[model samples]
Target: MTQGASGRDGGNSLKARVKTAKSRTLASTLWLQRQLNDPYVARAKREGYRSRAAYKLIEIDERAHLLKPGQKIVDLGAAPGGWSQVAAAKIGADKPKGEAKGKVFAIDLLEMAPMPGVEFRQMDFLDPAAPQLLREWLGGPADVVLSDMAANATGHKKTDQLRIIGLVELAAEFACEILGPGGAFLAKVLQGGTDTALLARLKRDFAQVKHIKPPASRSGSSELYVLATGFRGRREATGEDGAG
Candidate 1:
């Protein structure tokens, strides 16, 4: 991939444009054009991140103050491993023999190339055994849970939004089960107005819940991230505290 001299720095060149080919659909051609013009994509290549999505997490953490050293983190749907790379570097997981050393467990249905300081697992997160296996691998509860998963888009707006919401809600439930007290959860969501129930649930279980759209996300995209911090720990129906 190559980038021209035009970007946020205000060079005088025009944005890179992709010409549609006989075999390429217009949508695919437009997407290729956008990727060619996106500064984050070029920056990710230069900075050694697996995907441009890494900057979204970086922007979120810059303000949220999550991903501290010595914390154990779980990355769901982590194939391509952009977020895992950031988490590993931030939490000192790549450091050898240090008090600040941390652990990162990343899982996805698709295979991922090996990354330094990351343990990758290829499996469905919804598998009944996954939560226990991930906890065992981490050697305890996780301090942070990150989910960048999204359902396959069917191109129907409402249906797509519902599918994404369902996936994030499941990720949230998984985080609630595995995060230790005062932990945090971040997951992708759509910007439709239908996530009130999810927000309410997060508000009840976490000290803070907010929606954010990072600068890395394209202006016209509906992508938003739900960040829940300060997990209050699990509770039973009787209002008794339960193990996380």
Candidate 2:
């Protein structure tokens, strides 16, 4: 792939985009620096993935084999559709009729460019009506529910963590409501002795619960992924939004 100035291809993979010197603030400069030098960012563009976040899903899938031919998947907070793209491909979402026809249903607040094998809904996952709409579209339970959903960062540390935790909790509730028996759920989490309670709940719900820090995640980052598998079907009388 011929990488351009924006680093959209594999050619010159490690080269950084040169930026003009300006009177920008220190934080802005640092952010620009990080973006310019991020190899994963460049590689993601080259591979035509929506974002570098795609590789995190790839790493975990390599470990868990959650995406199978003809499997149905729900991509929570799949803005820009990177994870959705990966899941869609893994599940054989695109093919000639009756040829391993898998499905990927992705929901997010941000508009995303189209990707093959992905059916997208541009709406906030937090909307009260969102889950209903998703269910109507899915027509039944799904094989996997994956969440890369994150609350918009407010910069304050504790608040940001809490906000993301809330999103993760909501995703879990959605998973319990809709994931098929023996299904899987995955979420991005910040590591720091946080999310222990959430982890405990996940352990109770699934046969296996483990955490992974994928190589595609930035080294300076505190993010890790939680993988929960073998979902025990929810009992009757459980609410549509279960234990959010």
TM-scores for the candidates: 0.91, 0.85
Which residue ranges in model 2 land beyond 4 Å of their true spot?
Answer: 1-25, 97-100, 237-244
Candidate 1 per-residue lDDT, tens place, 176-240, comes to 88888899999999888338899888888898888888878889999999899999887753264
Clashing pairs in 2: none
lDDT assessment of candidate 1: 0.87
Clashes of 2: 0
Model 2 lDDT tens row, 1-244: 2344345455554655556567876667778888767766767777787788888899888877878988888998888888998998888886655674778998877787777788888877767777667767877788899998767778788988998887788889878777877889999888863477888778767888988888778878878888899887775544333221
Against the hidden true structure, what lDDT does model 2 obtain? 0.79
lDDT of 1 at 152: 93
* Residue 224 miss distance in model 2 (angstroms): 0.6
Off by over 4 Å in 1: 1-12, 97-100, 237-244
